[model samples]
Target: MSMATYIGLNFSVKLNEDYTEDEVEIDYVFSSEEDRNVVKQKHFTTPYIYEVFEKDEPIWRMNEDQKIHSPHNYEKSKKTFLYLCHLLKELLPKGDYCEVYICWLGEEVEECEGELKFNLNNLQIEAIDIYEKYFIRIEN
Candidate 1:
């Protein structure tokens, strides 16, 4: 018998304002297959921070909060969400039902997308379509 599993996908994006030197970060979690797929297709933006070292070394890094950008305003964030969903679908077994958890970290409080009461049925179907086109199934 196949074992039941819960899958989690974490996505983040960061945006730095060139003029203000301010940054915006965003994160999203897909708990249900339906929500996951919906989030994947949606368009959002990603924010990034650049740091200069003493030796003139330039480094780009994301915050520990794993915040990307505002999903309500950006398109890249949506793209990142989609990519995450793809990864989750590929990693999970086909026969087992899965519960996903998503967490989005911002400058302040983290925002959540899906709830345990809701399942990602539609999102899972979309993920499967993507998997068929991009992922190759392996036999154990």
Candidate 2:
């Protein structure tokens, strides 16, 4: 049997004197523990940076197949958001930054927030000031 959940992502950015916020809600469904495990592993092991810093455009794009799928896939959607954070890093002013939050749509899970910014070298996207309580936990 498949389990269903809704994931919510919210982004707030401060660039110089400007502020921007974006929010997305997703319907997530999975058939088994392995499905959740895959996403969890990628979340812990992958670096936040998706591409080189000098690129002017985002490297992530949804393929035809992804666009045709109903109810966005959880893993793909999460990766897309991560890439967006990188894009935010690129657009941030010298001293500006962005904040991201993740939470379950209807569940009692606590929301997790992280600050996204460039590293000292300004070549990599790094997440700092993170609250570790934010993540999906599946229980049997």
Each model's TM-score? 0.26, 0.26
Instruction: Write candidate 2's Cα lDDT for 5-59 as tens digits.
Output: 2222222222233322332222232323443333333332221211112111111
Model 1: per-residue Cα lDDT over 1-140, one tens digit each = 21111122232224233333212211222133444343233311212111111111101111112233432322333344344345434543554333322222121122333232212234532222111011112111
TM-score for candidate 1, please give it: 0.26
Clashing pairs in 2: none
For every candidate in turn, the CA RMSD to the true structure comes to 17.5, 14.3
Candidate 2 accuracy as TM-score:
0.26
Per-candidate local distance difference test: 0.26, 0.31
- Specify the poorest-scoring 10-residue window by lDDT in model 2: 49-58
The number of the candidate with the highest lDDT is: 2
Q: How many pairs collide in each candidate, listed in order?
A: 28, 0
